[model samples]
Target: MTTFASSLKKEIARVARKELKDELGALRKASASYRTEIAALKRQVRELQVALRQTSRRADKALHTVAPDAPAESPKRGRRAVFSAERFKAQRERLGLTQKDMAAYLGTSTLSVWKWETGQVTPRARFLPAILGLRTTGKREVLQQLARGAGGATD
Candidate 1:
């Protein structure tokens, strides 16, 4: 009777271990599948990020022109330069031009120039090209441009 009881206990233990192993094997397979899916998703995300960066660079290049005359090709859709009221005022002061002079240079009214300097209004998109055009001009070049606009002959 004692021998039969020991044999029964050992058989029960063996069966329990076999069942646990089967359960563990199934879990391991599912875990591997989940890991593979996660790795694939990570790879896809990396690829998408690279593609987005390339697209952004292309758009940025399109917005910025390389040549001086490139803005003339598309004045309405030319490179957009950043503008601020303080910067505008400072640039005008640095060029030693009065508000009226700046207005004349920008082909706008004196009131508009005042409004721009005072931050009463933002400059229109149509004026961005002209504003960017003058960013590189010196006081002498501005004077020359103003003179030319006043019907003075250019040398």
Candidate 2:
């Protein structure tokens, strides 16, 4: 009778261990899948952070550096008187530009520039801003503008 009872107890213990092994196997598989998904998410986050840093550097460069060929900004005022025939001629001569080059830079005809310099005709109100913009331009910038064909004329 004692031998029968011992064999029955051993059988029950073996069955419980088999049931627990099945449950633990499923749990382990789920844990591994979750770990792989988390690794993918972390990799994506790192790539986005690197891209954001590159974009920030580009924005900073655009904001801080001014181009040498760009014109200076003029202050806004109530109908500022910024153009005169003599001043126009002087600005052209100061940049060592001929009347033809001046006309191209200002996007006008050479005859019109000649007339403006001789004070025979006043330039139209439309040309005032471009004429005024030349006042602060340097000689090197003027030459560069001419070389690039200021009025869209190709060399």
Candidate 3:
């Protein structure tokens, strides 16, 4: 009876040890899976931060162009203006002409010239030819083109 009891106790101890070993293996697998998930989350966070920065830059550019009250900074890269009111005004003034004189030369009203100078209005598509022609051919061809209904001149 003493030998049978001792053997039974040994069997129970062996079964408990095997169960504990299996539990430990399962815990280790869970821990490794959690670690992988954490690493993936960190990488996603970094990618989102980069996307946020790019979006912010584009927003800043859009705001600067649309808002006249925004602080003036140096021109951005790869931006070009086909026409500039300030440049036009400066060039006309340098040529010692008043708005009325320039308007008469360009075959437009003085009010239109004033609007162009003050940035209240921009040149129309039909007027672009006249403006460019004025710059190139000294305003004579501009009126001639308007008279002929050929509103724009070719480059």
Candidate 4:
């Protein structure tokens, strides 16, 4: 009887060891699956963060590309007078442009513009077409004509 009881106890112990090993193997497999899921979630989070950063940068660039508001300077009142030296001076004053700015637009020196305005010298006959072009069609047309070598006098 003692022998049979001892054998029975040994069998029960062996069965319990096998069951524990199987349960441990199942737990390890579940842990590995959870680890893979965590890695995938981390990758997704990183991709989302990168996309968000790109979107924010584009929005910031668009905001910067918009033009700023003009300052509080008032517009000049009354009709523009005729195109003369005095009128040109008044126009320059009203427009708040310097002689250098006008010269730059005319492709000449400020001194030349000053001489024309002061009546010490007249603009060349060729320059009249340019001036008329500037007056009628605007500066862009004058510049285009100058570039195309058709800016000077017809004669």
Q: Which candidate gets the maximum TM-score versus the true structure?
A: 2
lDDT of 3 by residue, 1-155 (tens): 99999999999999999999999999999999999999999999999999999999876544323343433232234443244566568657765667866776666778998888776677666565556444545445544644565533332
lDDT for 46 (candidate 1): 100
Query: How should the candidates be ordered by lDDT, best one leading?
Result: 2, 1, 3, 4
Q: What root-mean-square deviation over C-alphas does model 2 reach? A: 15.6
lDDT of 1 by residue, 1-155 (tens): 99999999999999999999999999999999999999999999999999999999866544443343333333446633655666678788988999888888887888988887776676777776666566667999889888888411111
RMSD of each: 10.3, 15.6, 11.4, 17.7
lDDT of 1 at 51: 100
Please write out the lDDT profile of model 4 over residues 64-132, one tens digit for every residue: 222234222211344222234554455455545578766665667789879767755556655554443
> Which residue pairs in candidate 1 have backbone atoms (N, alpha carbon, C) closer than 3 angstroms, thus clashing?
none
lDDT (Cα, tens digit) per residue for candidate 2, span 69-104? 554445465534434566678788998989988888
| Model 4 whole-model lDDT (C-alpha atoms) | 0.62
How accurate locally, in lDDT, is each candidate?
A: 0.74, 0.76, 0.66, 0.62
How high is each candidate's TM-score? Answer: 0.45, 0.47, 0.37, 0.38
- Can you tell me which runs of candidate 3 are displaced by over 4 Å? 1-81, 137-155
TM-score of 2: 0.47
Task: Give, for candidate 3, the lowest lDDT window spanning 10 residues.
Answer: 72-81
lDDT winner:
2
